[model samples]
Target: MRFKPHFEKIRFIFGAIVVVTISGCFQIFGSGPATFIKKSFNPSKTKQAILFWKGGNATSGNSLQVSIKGAGDDLDKAEVGNVFTVDDDHGKARLNPKAIRLIWKSDRQLNIEYDVNLRTFIQLKRFNDDTIVYRTFKPVIPANHMD
Candidate 1:
């Protein structure tokens, strides 16, 4: 009877440690909530483009993800079809809708424009049948010079 109480305490401590470890892993690996930034439809309105910001912890920083989906696809059910990732060292200045511009030149062509300083982690030249083109202002300073 005396040993039973001690065993129960040990089990509780072990369970708590396991839970804390799992939660810490999630914080390190998983991103925080995604905030919708902007959306645009193709000229034909058959397909849609979405831009959102996925918040991250201090280690991961914030990221901008661009996705394409059907016009009628549910925003909640659709996974983030991340075609481009703007990795500006987790800078949140570009979280606004105006920060990233998306212009559909035609049903098959898309023009994306953003700051030249922002490094693109993933830049797809094409998404499905749409040809993607990126435009940026000439960097006055070399990329390596930027802190």
Candidate 2:
């Protein structure tokens, strides 16, 4: 007897839903999933930031990392205890005046905010998928200065 293609497709979809539901249930009940989801969606409110230095290439690293430049006249003089938020559609980083740095090797695009600086970058990878793998660095500079 021959099986119908439609039946196979339905079976595949049903199996996938079962797998997802099982995982979601586990996540809902465990701290691991809760913490993972929290961090994944809201990284900007938890990570720390450091100063930025040139000479770092984005193409030669396992993960893309972002750092704030602290030498600019306006940025260097900003209050030391200030805080900022950095985010992409996929994740976010919460940073304080210490300066914000992030390494996103699995994200394609990101939106970062530091003090008054907001910038975005497109991560480059080997696939046509929307999952970009890149890092972005933003500083507490004026909007006009961002490129």
Candidate 3:
């Protein structure tokens, strides 16, 4: 009867040790929640406008929405069929289409078809480029008109 009580006590202690060892291993070896880890590793692949027209009239084709892709946003917004450019970065600047008269990048230039009065014009092609270089004036016949 004495040996019976000792055996029960040993059995209880051995079972408790096994349970605690298994539990400790789980806590030490397991990573954080699987979902949270996966979410942090992979980001959403959404197409956001790296450069977008915050304000532009798309109906008249005054300004175009240029993107990383060769294709641009088909928003037609313009006033008097004119768009202005400026040296200001991240700020709105007035553009005079008459100032340059013709601007192009590569073979792609501003394709504007205008009536004699200059009331309205349709843009047949858009100047799509990542960078633009301007030429200084050298005195032309009409001035401000590039030949």
Question: Which structure among the candidates has the greatest lDDT?
Answer: 1
* Model 2 agreement with the true structure over 54-128: per-residue lDDT tens digits: 111223211122322222223232222122223221223222332333333334322332332322342233222
Name the weakest run of 10 consecutive residues (lDDT summed) in model 2. Answer: 32-41
Winner by TM-score? 1
For model 3, which pairs clash? 57-76, 57-77, 58-75, 58-76, 58-77, 59-76, 59-77, 84-95
> How well does candidate 1 match the true structure in TM-score terms?
0.78
For model 3, state the Cα shift of residue 117 in Å.
62
The Cα local distance difference test for each model comes to 0.73, 0.32, 0.30
- Distance from true location, Cα of 9 in model 2, Å: 0.3
Candidate 3 Cα RMSD after full superposition onto the native fold (Å): 22.7
lDDT of 2: 0.32
Residues 26-85 of candidate 3 have per-residue lDDT tens digits of 656543221100000002222111222223322222222222222332323221112322
RMSD of 2: 18.3
Model 1 CA deviation exceeding 4 Å by range: 77-81, 90-94, 138-147
Candidate 2, pairs of clashing residues: 43-92, 43-93, 44-92, 44-93, 44-94, 45-94, 49-99, 49-100, 107-132, 108-132
Candidate 1 vs candidate 3: the lDDT winner is 1
